[model samples]
Target: MPKAKETVLEIDLKALEHNYHFLKSKLKPNTKFLAVVKAFAYGSDSATVAKKLQDLDVDYFAVAYVNEGVVLRDSGITKPILVLHPQPVNFKTLIERCLEPSLYNAKILKEFIAVADAENQTNYPVHIKFNTGLNRLGFWESDTDYISEHLKATKAVKAISVFSHLAASEDLTEIDFTKTQIKNFTAIADDLSSKLGHTLWRHLCNTSGVLNYPEAHFDMVRCGIGLYGFGNAPEYNTELKPIATLKSVISQIHKIEPEESVGYNRAYTSNGYEKTATIPIGHADGISRQFGLEKGAVFIQGKSAPIIGNVCMDMIMVNVTGIDCTEGDEVIVFNANHTASEFASTANTISYEILTAISQRVKRTFLH
Candidate 1:
């Protein structure tokens, strides 16, 4: 990769391939891999990412909404796409596009059936989401009977897959809770499968769950962050490479005299005479306002340059007093060396938030 002339999020297809294979290594040969391409493939151009993954023969792709799946469909993605949080209004379009919906609650399940019936669909694939421990979404354990009855009553929709989300699979301290969630999910899957009178594809593992729980990798595994180079743990992180590198160039350099301030609201005042380099990336570009005043940094000339003052909507000034840098010099906001995870730690956040928060305005270049 060359030095970026401007702010660019470099998408490394080769690295993505490496991470995909690495994650795939953890699963059994017969297990299916579902790539989560929602949030623009973690804010790195979903069309490009999904195309690359499609070429790699990823079994399935998951997105947060029906529109996201439609974009992939328009981009020539032919694989099955699961809309994890689809709405009733888009159910018709979802079916028209051949996108499967994760029918979670009873109302959503009934509504989707109505739409599927209106379209005169037969045995349309739909996933049933059960709430194991993640109270955020999905039906309750007892809702299995309700779901089974509804599916038996309607030939319009079929529960092709039954799944759940893990609440704290990445936290070792929550091992007991995570295990309990898994056990409960298995019970629910069995009960639902027996009630339905046919075997349904069972999956209950996310990125962390895939890494930590091999027994729960039932029929398929949904991997999101792991495919983008995060393993959710220090040991596993060594095996995967980050697929996206956020890079920018110093737009200008400013020499600040003692008592002089930088950025909006005069948030930072120079304690001593120092030099600052302003980069064309800020809150609007996904560098949140929480990352400023020496908390966040951008690597320049292989040296750490702390961000100064309040991060503006369009730019951020970093203290580059000792770094030998000039205008237009390449600046690394976060990459493998000074990773997005580390940078996000400075703001007390996580890699997922930072990676997905990257603005679409940033030019996305790729390396294959």
Candidate 2:
């Protein structure tokens, strides 16, 4: 296909499939797969990514909010969707769209129960989130009895799964801590399931958890970053394929003499005559201003061109000095080869931050 847009995020569906199959292979034969498509599928295109995963027979989809799940539903995504952080205001809408909520606290559980009862809903599916060690959302272990009592009394909602988040599942130095979290979650989930008088799907593994802690796979495994081609670890990273490529083109070029600076605040000044190429992307396009000269770079003509000056809202200059490139030549901001992990580390951030920070205005093209 011809280039129809100047700045575009190319999503490789084949690579997504590769990532899905690769992660799924780590789970037990009976274990279910829930693909996280929140944050616009890590800034790729939630609907497109979810549709692809749906075609791959993924057991479930997860988003951070009810509106995201509604979007998937509107796009005809029939697979079960779990809203990780549902608000009381959207509880009715969540039910209307058949999206399950991860009831992390008593307030959410009570509020959702009220809504479900008011709607005359019965045996509604819900996921229970345990605090474990994340200490963010989720209920405390002591709340299990309360939750079970409420479920038994109201019968308004049923717990289909019990899950917890690992705070340091990616850190090898925190292996002991991760084990502790797993043990705590297992104990809580088992107790809750027993009180409820039925089995509950227990899952506590994120991408790193899936790779490093196979023993915690439980009845299902939730894979997020790994499905988009990052393991947060060197060994596992080598086995995955990045599915998003942020690409732009050289819109213009400038030759500046010594003492001339580029971008806002004169953040970068040339000591000698320099050749620079301006690309049509910047902070507004998810390239953080922290990636100024000497920090991050873009790939052009297979050569690295250091970013020059502060990233602007719509443009950035690169020190292209000796690069054999011209106006309109493709410049890869980040992709599989350069890797978002390497790119984001330049700004002292993680790959998740960089990937999810990509702007929606950047047109997306899917490659099958």
Candidate 3:
């Protein structure tokens, strides 16, 4: 394929590997690492990220849905993949793709078991998600009896692991709550194991959990944002390298007279005689309208250019009055100097939102 001539999201594979090794080094020798590659690997291209992680000998891969796992599988990924929220409609395809599902409720459990039985599958591996404290999706502690019964009834399927999510592992102030969650999850895992008379791998640590609670890192640790470079803590920022950099080029430049308005709805007016550089990127390209009207800015010539005016569907205007540049000058949206977290903070959102909100229409270029 010809190289893209417009905006591009530069993905750094070496930085990805570096983050993976950094997290791995922190874990116990026996602790497994599962790289979360959902939302197109946090909008950086799942197939590429999964392929790199696979080459890195990652213990496992995880996605939010069955189709995502299928994507990885079709891309020649052979490692075990956990589907965090598999729906009943795709159970057949999931099974066919050798994707494991995290059974969170009794209804899903029974439904999946029936499908597994009809398919005449033996020992189909599945993971059970317990609701430790997230209160999102997962079986509640009170539903343990139902889980025990279901496991015993579905002898055709194998319970490979029992896992729960920590709701606030990133907040050190919530240590007591975190400990309570771990304790509850451990108790439930132990109870289930005893009743089922089988050993089930138990996991409760995400990136933050792994960093804060070593004891909760039972059999595996699921690292998502951390693997992409954010450590979920201020202290680890210096150690992790961001893996994605967004860049675009100036499409045109216009000189604005003082008191002259710019862009749709005249959201911004020139404070003084200044130069405005319009870039071929906007809300349609995942740069939200919130970024317009002075909320967002980009870096040009190693200096910040404040965005001015309403963000249009296909373009935005940046104040480049004094920047030594012309049409086609390179602009950095986020990079080593200006991180995604900084951008997110400026946009009043989170890093995950900014990362995943990147539109697929934007071209992706990988750099080792």
C-alpha RMSD by candidate, in order? 0.7, 1.2, 1.8
Ranking by lDDT: 1, 2, 3
What pairs collide in candidate 3?
A: none
Candidate 2 residue lDDT tens string, 76-106: 8999999999999999999999999999888
Candidate number with the higher TM-score (1 or 3) = 1
The global Cα lDDT (0 to 1) of model 2 is 0.92
Taken over the whole model, the C-alpha lDDT of each candidate is 0.94, 0.92, 0.90
lDDT of model 1 at position 308: 91
Best by TM-score: 1
Mark the regions of model 3 whose C-alpha exceeds 4 Å error after superposition.
1-5
Clashing pairs in 1: none
- Model 1 ranges with Cα > 4 A deviation: none
| Deviation of model 3 at 215, angstroms | 2.0
> Mind sharing the TM-score for model 2?
0.98
Tens digits of per-residue lDDT, candidate 3, 1-368, equal: 22234789999999999999999998989988999999999989999999999999999999999999989999999999999999999999999999999999989999999999988899999999999889999988888788888888776698999999999999999999999999999999998888778999988899888788888899899999998899878788778999999889999999989999999888888889999999988898889998888888999888899888988998989999899988877888998679999988887998898899889999999987
